[model samples]
Each structure stands twice: as structure tokens, then as C-alpha cells.
Target: MPLGKGELTTTATSLHILELIVDHGWVTLRGLVEETGLAKSTVHKHLSTLRANDYIVKEGERYTLGLYFLTVGKRAVEFRESYQLVEQKVRELGSRTDAEVDFTVEENGRLILMFEAAGATNESTFGTGTEFFLHNTAAGKAILATYADSKRDEILDTQGLPATTNKTIQSREALHAELEQVRENGYALNDGECVEGYRTVSSVIKRPNGSALGAISAGGPAYRIDQSRLKNELADHVRSATAEVTESLVEAQSTL
Candidate 1:
């Protein structure tokens, strides 16, 4: 039997529906039809297929992701294994410095906050599941700065340089030059770029093969960070903590 182009397109649409469910958490059948611009019948058919595969589930009129995604996400993180280690190190860093430490992973063209911990002295208006602008945060720059020129340019082009604060980098040329400095220093620093009073310093978390896995950052108010006065002290602390986390990751990888 010959398979028609329409059938092939239908299969692709089904996969896209499942992906949308996973990405958006929950969506109504009507919303899926509107978002996908597919026929209502087509959307229903795809949703049924996804449900049959356990990739999605429906509760009354609403559909959400199912446990299959949990299994998939767990396996993916388990394969990498550094996610938990980095989380532990961030907590340790926060406790030792008495400041807020956050870890973020780059997924699907965005920085996803994976873990966070705050010490007694820590104060930053960020928490888990907070996604930040890739151009305006130290953690984001740390991950992006490690990317190849073309790859970085593509992201910048898509996201552009939306200013979060007056200090935010606006020009592509200026950001390009700043990323060059980050590459040279093996870390990135954002002094009130994301928020008026908040500052952060971060380094890329890399695999043994030098691929960027995520970033670890320490953030607090400008009154305390004072980069010019405390540059060496802060950098030394962050560098040591990052190194420790990297080493732990290496050890864990061996056991895998």
C-alpha cells in the first residue's frame, strides 16, 4: 500500500501535539486546535494517539502531560547525572557564603531554573521555575558565552537584546565583545543588568568533553556585591565552589 503525503503530515502533527502538551503543561482540545491551526478533527485524532501512547492524559475537558514524560525526563537527567550534583554544590555555596545561589540549565532555547538555595544573608527575588532573559543575567551569559559564534548569534537574533535594566547590554556588538571577555575569564558577571540592585557572578558548568550543561551563580544586592571592592574575594569563592562541583561531576560520571 502506498502512503500518501497527507498521512505523513498527520503523523508529524500528532508528535507536535504531544510536544505542545509537554511544553505547556495542560491545554484544552480547543486551545490545541487554535494553537496548532489544525482542523478540530485532526487535533482530536492526534490527541487520542498521544493518549494511547501515554504521552498525554485528559481530565474532563482539559488535557495535561502524563507520567511518561516523567520517565523520559528522569532518564535524560540520569544520563547526564550532574544536575543533582550541581544542585548540592549550589546549596553548599549558598551556605558557605551566606548568599543565594542558583543553578540553571539551557533547554529548548531558554534558561530553566533547576535549583536554588538561600542562606541567612541571601536576598534575591528569584526562585525555582523562574526563567530569565538570556542576554541580561550572569548565569545565562555564562552558558551562552561558551557557545560557538554562529550559534550565539542565532540566539541573539531570535531573542534580541531586551533591556531589563538601564545597565543591560543593548548593542549586539557590545554583547559580542562582552561574551569575548567572558570566554577569556572562564566566567561571566552581571552587575545590575537583570535588575537595578541585583548583581551576580557565574561560571559555565561543562561536561568533560567541554559541552555546556548549565551554569552556577551567586546573586545578591549591589550594596553587598560591590565588585570593584570585593572582586578577588568573591571570584575566589565562586571559582573554588565551581571547581568543587565540576570535580564531583567528574567522579559521578566515572561511576556511570
Candidate 2:
């Protein structure tokens, strides 16, 4: 039996809504309407379809990714070669520096923490599976610095460079200047910018294709990780870790 045009359109809209929700967890109906720019009735109808499909679920008045998303995300993590190598690098960095290390990747214009390891003496403000605005973190800055001007502009336009803290780089111009420094310095630093009293240094890991696979960050309390240490010691360690992980990735890819 052939489906009617209205039914097909409804199905398409429902899929689109599900895509948005899966990418960003917990969105209000108003937020969805604004994000999709669809009429309220249309958005509601699509949300209903997505709810029925188990692709999304409502909590109070907000909608979020469902069990299905967890299953998929887990599968994606399992298949990612970068995650495995990055995890090893994180552990090594943590053990060497006595600091917390995180492996982050930029996905859909956001920094996703894929894995984390903490040294015996380390403490940190962030945890595993945490996500951050790509324009505000050391990991994000390192990754963005590798891209060309047009690519960097496109990424900033999509991510919007939102201010997460007073210390965050709020203006695109400022972020651009920061990225330039990252390129010159061969690493990036977040000096209590993402969160007060916490500092981090990071570097990018590139795939064989020269695209950013992810980043490696070494972080500790601001008292121990001062501006001077962040610029010199932490930055150097993170860059070495990044190189180690990328080499492992390249070797693994060659075997496959």
C-alpha cells in the first residue's frame, strides 16, 4: 500500500526531530520549536511520533535521548579507534604528571569527553562524558587551531562561541587571537576559563587524513596548575600524549 503525502511528510518531520533530540539531550517543546523552526502543532505531532518510536522520551515538560540512543552511543564508542588509543595516552599522562587527563573529541561542533583517567594525586572540575562549548576549552582551542581560516569560521558560526564563564573568550575576534597563539605555541591552555580554580592544557591529535581525531587534556587545581606551569609543563606533556595517541591510531589503522 502506498503512503499518502501527509503521512510521508509527518514521518520525515519526526525523523528530523529525533535527530535534533539525539544530538542534544533534554530540550523543551519551545526550544524544539525554535530549533526546528516548525509550527507548534507540527513539532508536537513529530515529538509524539518520536516518543512512540522509543527514540525519545519526555521528562516533565522536556524531551531527551532514550535507551536507544545509549545503545547506539555505546556501539559508536566501541568502534572508535581513537577512543582506545586516547584512553591509553590519558592513563600515561595521568601517571606521569599526577594530573587528571581527559580524551575529548569534537562532534557536531561540541567537545565530547570520551574517556578520562585520574592520577593518584589529581583532582579536577570535569568528569567523564562531560561536554563543553568548543570555543571555551583548551581541547577545543587546540583542535580548532589546526583548521584553515574558512573551516574555523564555519565551526565558530555553528558553535556560536557562547560564554561559559567570565574568563571564557566571548568574542570571535578574541578566540581568533587565542587560536593564533595556539598555532604558534604548539599547544593550548585553559587557565580557569572553563571553570574557576581549575586549569588545563591540551593538544590536538590528527587522523591520517590530517583531520582532527580528538584532543588530550591534562588538568589540575589552579593552585598547582598556575599560568606558568600551564603554558610550559602541562602544555608539553599534553602535546607528547597527543602525539603518542595519534601514532598508535595510525599504526592500528594501517593494520586494518
Candidate 3:
């Protein structure tokens, strides 16, 4: 639902129910009723529609997300030339640095994982469809820096920054300060913000007008990325990755 919108269309209600099902994996109509507070009749009606469309699958009484989304997600990834180009770069970066690499995008105001590659050294905690805090992770913060002020405020107002680790930025003022630093440095750093022992360096891939296309990151255990390495070596790799991805995307767009 859009912020400050008190009325929810039945379709929106149904979509919400579907999203809940997607997040929970499997749920009963009764469970949906309890979670959504929708009447059994309303929930059943929506579930019937969903099941008929193959958006949800039913087994006895439990409902699971349908396979239709698998095709859709695959097609979507292929449709975005950036994903293909970025995936190769992410994999290359991961293989070279032996650090977990990720490509993340802001969609519907959520920082979502688009692609992930485990480094030979094994250092990140991201996977496809992972939605993370915009104020914490390096990828999140890098993307956040590109959002307009009003849009950024709307996101923060909707998704309040919460402490994931002791080092996570909790205050809006602090986050703003950090975003400024990200702009100056052309990259962002995550020093045990999302996970206690993890660190990351990220840079945003931006379009010509300076809006972000997404962000790319290299992350690993804090022991593997000390402050000096985070600022220097890791930052260099992340900047290069973002530059390559952005340049490829611009070229692809020009061809289109």
C-alpha cells in the first residue's frame, strides 16, 4: 500500500495476501485469515482467484507459491541486460578477490538482491530476492545515496532504520551524514553493520542522469577486510566493478 493511503482495493488486499504467502512459503487459509484479519469468505475468494490463475498452489489445505513466478523471474532477469552483464562482473570479482559479491537494486523502495556469487573465500550473506536494510549494508547505503530527498524520506519513514548489529546506523541524522560521505567517496562501507563479523565495500551503478541502476558489492568477514583494506583495496575493486557494470548498461541502452 502507498503511504498515507487509508483505503485498500480488494486487489491490493489479495496481492498483500499473496505476498504474505510468498514470504511464509506455506500457509493455510485460516492462517492467512489470522495474519491478514480478512474474513474467511474474503480470503477464500482471493485464494480461489489466485489458485485458478496458478499464482498459488494448493495441497489439501496448505497453500504454496506457484511455479509461474519461476518463469516470470527468469524472463525478467534475461530481459534486464544489466543483470547479465552485472552477473558476469560479480562472478569475476568474486573469483578474483575471493570475497562474496552481490548486485542489488532498489525496487518498490526495497533494496533487493538481483545476483550473488560466493567468493572462493566465502564471505557474504546475500542471495536472489534478499531484501535488506537500506541504512546498513554497503550495497543498500550505496543505492540509498542516489535516491531523491523526498523519496529517501518516504522510504525511511516507511522502513525505519533498526539495529541489526551494534554498529548499524539507527538515527536519521547519522544516516544522512553517512550518505554524504558515500557521495564524496563514490562508495560505501559496511563495518559490521548488518552482521557482527562481516564487512563490505560497495559502489552504485548509475544512469546518465545520476540515478542509480543498482549497486555492486564485495563482502567478507571483518578479519579478511580490515579498515585499511576496506578503504583502499576493497574500495578499488568495488569502484571498478560498478564502473564496468554502469558502462556496459549505458552501452546496452544506447543500442536499444
Candidate 4:
């Protein structure tokens, strides 16, 4: 949730410190103070509290995130209703296509990678828990294509179409036009939009009611996944995988 007026500033400070630690890998008390511009005593107190709670580990003067975060992250992934099915399909798609496969869902108007399966090449840098904008990736576009215009516009308004690469769609009108094609094609393509020299193909997974649940994507280096292969082969592979996952999700929901 967005921070509201009169919310606990202390909690926000603690989370901000944690995020800094995550971004930098490890940090010292002085580093946190410098980064946050908070008083040294305040930073020390938050660090001490987090260390006591096992949320961070201290090595000499440096602190890193603790294994407790891993435990919590595991529970969060398993808590998703479609995680199991998505996991299975991600693995299968990776093996079948020899490209990195990812299953992503929208949270707070951003795409979050929920599950990922490394391809044989192991060249992909993305992993589970990676968060990115919805206008720069094939998976995000696939999900956006499935959303109602009002819902899609809301997310776009909240998270403006920032350009990641020169090829990224930066205008709402242009994105809407591509999304229309994505709807008709049953898949979305990312041709060096998010990361230059990389390409991706994705298809949306839908719930029983036909609302988008998430998206499944396969991506690789542009040379390996050239335009022809991206449109025909990889697109088919991603669409097939998403179709299977959507079918299984619908069946499971019906039983429940």
C-alpha cells in the first residue's frame, strides 16, 4: 500500500534501510547512515533491532540480509494459488525451448517474477523476485493485453511508460496499438525493449472467469532468438505453456 499520512515513519525507515542493504549486498552502520541521511543513533537502533530479529546478519561491521528472508520468500511463493502449476510449466518450457522461462504476475502495477527456470545456456540474468515496469517486457504486455481498458489504463497511469531501451514503447497510444495486435496474435514480443541484445516472447494465463492470472515468457539472446524464431517458434512455445497452465488452474478452481 502507498504510504498514507500519519503512518509509522519508523517502519518506513526500517524498510528503507532493509532495501538499501538488499541493493548493496552488505552495509555498515556508517554506510546506512550516509545512505539514509538519518542520525547515526537511529540507524544503529534499527540495525540492532533487525539483527536481534534475525532479519540481518552482522559480519564484523558489515551487515547482510539473513536466511530468514529466504524462509519468508519461500512461503510467499508457495502462497500463490497458481505457483505449483506455473513452476511446472516454467521448467517444461525452459527445457523445451532452451530459453530462460519466467512466470510473472502483476502486483501494485508492476510485474514481479514469481517463478523462473534457467535454460541450458544459463545466460539470463533475471531470477525469481525480480521486479520491473509493465511497459518494457513481453510478459507485462501479454498481461496488459488481457486486461480491460480501464484496468490497463489505471496501471499505465500509475506507472507511466518509462523507456528502458530506445525500442521500449514510451507513448500510451503506441502501446495501446501494440496491445491490440498482441490480443489478436495471442502473444507479445519484446525485441530488445527491456534489455538491448535480448528478445522475449510471452502469453498471458487467464483465470476461469477469463481475467488475467499472470504471464509465462521465454527469453534469450537476440542472435539465438532472431525475429523469425521469436515470432514463430518461441511464441508458439510460450502460448502453449500458458494455455496448459491456464487449463490446470481453471480445473483446480472448479474443484475448489
Count backbone clashes in candidate 2. 0
Off by over 4 Å in 4: 1-3, 118-123
Each model's lDDT comes to 0.80, 0.82, 0.86, 0.88
Question: Relative to the unseen true structure, what is the C-alpha lDDT of residue 114 in candidate 2, on a scale of 0 to 100?
Answer: 84
Candidate 2 residue pairs in backbone clash: none
Where is model 3 more than 4 Å wrong at Cα?
Answer: 1-8
lDDT of each residue in 1-256, candidate 2, tens digit only = 2355667766677777777776787888999888878899888988887788888889999999779867887889989756776777788888888887888988877888988878887665577678898788899999999888898888888778677678988888898898999989888888778887788888999897878988888878877777887778888888887887677778888999
**lDDT comparing candidate 4 with the true structure:** 0.88
Candidate 3 minimal-lDDT segment of 10 residues: 1-10
Tens-digit lDDT track of model 1 for 28-124: 9999888978789988988888888988889999999888876886677678666878877888888887767888887766787878878776665
Residue 169 of candidate 3: its Cα lDDT? 90
Worst 10 residues of 4 by lDDT: 118-127
- Cand. 1 TM to true fold: 0.78
Candidate 2 regions exceeding 4 Å error are 1-52, 57-65
* Residue 177, model 4, lDDT: 92
Best by the TM-score measure? 3
In candidate 3, how many Å is residue 126 off? 2.6
Candidate 2 lDDT? 0.82
Give per-model CA RMSD: 4.6, 5.4, 2.3, 2.3
Assess every candidate by TM-score: 0.78, 0.78, 0.91, 0.90
